[model samples]
Target: MDLPRSFTIRESGHRIHNPFTSEKLATLGRALGLAPGTSVLDLACGSGEMLCTWARDHRVTGTGVDISTEFLTAAHARATELGVTDRVAFRHGDATGHVADEPVGVAACLGATWIGDGAAGTVELLRRSLAPGGIMLIGEPYWRREPRDQATVEGCYATTKDDYRPLPELLELFGRLGCGVVEMVLADQDSWDRYVAAQWLNTRRWLDAHPDDEMADEMREDLATGPVRHVRYQREYLGWGVFALMNR
Candidate 1:
């Protein structure tokens, strides 16, 4: 299976699918202080960036699962490029309910937590594959400010404001799940701009290449309005971070 063509096209250039930049991702890896040969299982690991990079930098061994075949291909290539092909493997499959064949030191479900429906359920799903006292890496979005109205919610690409909680509430959620927030690295507006603005260019280039495609019109419309919408709504209202958690 694969992600929608539109999504794959829009994010084709991205090494990390979420708002995270390579530097932020590297910082997270360092913060984790992963030991050599540490075992990691990354769910919904787009392009296997975290797994591949960590394999190279921390000497970790891991498997990554994602539904997107295109991304899996990129992941394999990334592994090769990083000289970690023997250390990391990527599988094309649904990440939801995916349990590792063996317990892992780090179990992560980043960005696509909807695989377990939401953050709490996602944490539970990750725990199923985690070794005792292992870390759970969860990447989620929180509302930086309350959306003003329905228009604001729509602008943030959410159906309702309930889609995300404020930062404090999100931390409380981890506590409620019987985990403590150990470490976190957040995305700033610059990284957000880098992520969202890059999509605009990708969409524009794709539209030029596939002028007759049926999706062109939709992409065109999105490219036309995406920047302003992101600046006004998502950049201001949405805060994204990858949190490191441990059982309390």
Candidate 2:
């Protein structure tokens, strides 16, 4: 019913929980042109930043589901902070196969497409909860440039180059799924650094506070080596974006 403790600990300080900066996230929300009372269902919604922020900015109502109790707690607190508790609800549960009780104007599974195995299946799962003319938002990674070798692919955190398509092919995938890519907000290198490098600091702080914790060594190792790996490979070869789609 939850992500591993280590995973949550590593990202405990993250607000958006992805490579997207707050500005990029707001841009995507504005691009959606949401109307008052528009319903959104965000699967794997991690701290529910999008739901809470959208509720405040766009006056949309939404529900978020995530398997991490820790994250769900933060999400609820964020809703309260934004004074949007009345507009959003968060549930601690598995996101895989999750569906909204009512058809929604937007359905999203960002950054955790493994909920449906991969991008194609995740799009199908989101479609099940979407109303006609609703938008589907998918946040996914793509290859910025073709990797030169298996080691390069692994450095980008993929077991194989096929794990992610190049950016052009990724866009082509939406068309194959009967959805048109209407809008997108991409993550720049600065955002990527913020996302990944911030985790190292969080890990270091955690390690300093709990040197005796069983996970300390692992966090220490991550803090020691994560930066170079990221700057060397991920920043160079990987790209991420949130794509907005509508059924054709």
Candidate 3:
């Protein structure tokens, strides 16, 4: 019913959880031209940043579902902080099969497509909750450059070369699924650094404060190796973006 403690611990300080920076997220929101009272459904919405922020900026109302109670707590707090408590809601639940009770203007599964098994399945899941002509937002990673070897692929955290497609293939995927790629905001190397490097500091700070905790050793190892692996393999070979789609 909840995410692993280690997962939340590693991202304890993250608001948007993915490689997207605040500016990139805001840009996507603006690009959509969200209107007041536009309803959104966000699955696997880590910390509910997208929902809460859009609720404030665009006056969109939304529900965010996640399996992490810790993240849900933070999401609720963020809604209150942004003075948008009436506009957004966060529920602690599995996002895999969840759908909006009512069709929404936007249906999203950002950065956690695995909830529906993969991009295609995730799109299917989102479509179940999308109103006619509604936008679907999918956040995913792509190969920036083809990896040279299996070792490099593993270093980038992919078990195989097929784990992620290149950008063009990803756009083609949307077309195959009967969706048109309408807009996208990509992550730069600096955004990747901001996302991955910040995790190291969160892990390190947790280790300093809880050296005797059961997961301390694991956190220490991640802190020691994560940055090197990220900069050398992932940051250079991987790119991430949140794409906006409309049914074709």
Q: What do the candidate models score in CA lDDT, each in turn?
A: 0.94, 0.94, 0.94
Kindly report which residue stretches of model 3 are placed more than 4 angstroms away from their true locations once superposed.
none
How far does residue 11 in candidate 1 sit from its true spot (Å)? 0.1
TM-score versus the correct structure, for each prediction: 0.99, 0.99, 0.99
* Candidate 2 residue pairs that clash: none
In candidate 2, what residue range of length 10 has the lowest lDDT sum?
A: 216-225
| Cα lDDT of model 3 by residue, 10-70, tens digit | 8999998999999999999999999899999999999999999999999999999999999
Candidate 1 segments whose C-alpha is farther than 4 A from its true place: none
Q: After superposition, how far is residue 170 of candidate 2 from its true place, in Å?
A: 0.5
lDDT of 2 by residue, 1-248 (tens): 78988788889999889999999999999988999999999999999999999999999999999999999999999999999999999998899999899999999988999999999999999999999999999999999999999989999999999999999999999999999999999999999999998888888888889999988888788788889999989999999999999999
Score candidate 3 by TM-score against the native: 0.99
The Cα error of candidate 2 at residue 117, in Å, is: 0.6
